[model samples]
Target: MSEARPYGFEVVRLARLEARLVVYDWAWARDNAERVTENWRRRVAGQPALFDGPVLLACDCAIVGEVCRLSLFETTYARFLAYRDGGSPDGHVANAFAAIVPWSADGAVLLGRMGAHTANAGQIYFPCGTPDPGDVRGESVDFSGSAGRELLEETGLDLPEDAPEDWVCLRGEGQLAFLRPVRFSDAAATLIDRMETHAIREDEPELSGIVAVRSAADIDAAMPGFVRAYLASAFDAGARARRRRT
Candidate 1:
């Protein structure tokens, strides 16, 4: 196996982001839909709670000096899933969106385990979802809104409406994780217990359980590749902070 490349991210704050559907790339979109159908037949053993709703998937991106300018437009949820499984005909499509990495003051990162009936069953990841039409205001993308809505829907932990520590975009393969931190005053155990109880009470819960990660080793094999990379970066940063304190 090849050596795993370290994930690189650009620190960008949530500001004016333009996300309007440009002219639909017909050929590209059709190819993406075909790929999605193929993959769904092979990978998905059963039906998932999916909708044919339209979403914006990145068609192009580039690092212009210090900024990463992305070109995104409308595509269906089916196409987005297909694009996620390396189905983009142009190979430029990316799963680009924001997520909330809830952290306690005591060095614990809270992650959620997907329920068996959900699309990402058994996978471990932070509370987040893909950006949809609900996240758009005029032409700008409201990543903070996307982050907060997803966190509330999944974990039921209502964060202060306007407090995100920092924003970073993790790029690898076909994924782009726009992650933001939501710090809590509660201890790890307390937060985990609360989240788990919330999940249990949910009618159609997305998460089956909550996992509290205090160290890198606590990140298990069930986590997706991008999630593991994020955890590794987070853990290393924590270690360096401890060294500074010492």
Candidate 2:
């Protein structure tokens, strides 16, 4: 958790992302609802308030210069979960999550273990969440605000409004994760200790604990695939740089 090796990440930010609803896949949704409900009941004890929320599914993405142009459409949370859990094959619905890879000055990366009561219990990932209605500003998505809010809410750490940023997007299966790398002045141990304390002291905290990943070997099965993928590339770059320095 305490090392001085630099992560050397290029920070990215998403100033604005467009989002909107699409044509109803009534036939698919009708068939998918029952399975989604049952699966939800199994995975989540009791019921979380189900809403006809907008889930941003990526229909197409192309890099136009540095910006990624994503064709996104909206669907309900129920339908999104169905596609997420593989109960439905409808690629029409995609879940979009925004997160920041918090890197300590000492090169350690902090991750969070989700609390049991949460939907992704025991799963480890960077502090992030699904973009909700509040994230919608006018007709555009506020990715930076969402990432900043989630980081503060979960770990009690805040990145300045003017923090340097770069948008890094990753996709797998039917899901897309939009990530921003945020650097912290704190060392890894300090951040981990502070986050762990926050998780314990906060009321009904969403995170169970903080995990410090210093190397690719530190990544475990509990972490989401996207996290492991990102860390692997980062650590590999660090290793190569160190080798060259030596």
Q: What is the clash count for each candidate, in the order shown?
A: 0, 9
Give the CA lDDT, 0 to 100, for residue 145 in model 2.
Answer: 84
What's the lDDT for all of these models? 0.72, 0.70
Report how far residue 126 has shifted in candidate 2, in Å.
0.5
Tens digits of per-residue lDDT for model 1 on 51-86? 567776676665444345666677677767666656
Please give, for residues 17-80, the per-residue lDDT of candidate 2 as tens digits.
4444333444576876788777666655543533446655555655444565555555566666
Model 2: lowest-lDDT 10 consecutive positions? 1-10
Model 2: what TM-score?
A: 0.82
Name the runs in model 2 displaced over 4 angstroms.
1-27, 44-55
**Candidate 1: segments with Cα more than 4 A from true spot:** 1-21, 24-26, 38-45, 62-68, 87-89
Q: How close is every model to the real structure, measured as TM-score?
A: 0.84, 0.82
Score candidate 2 by lDDT: 0.70
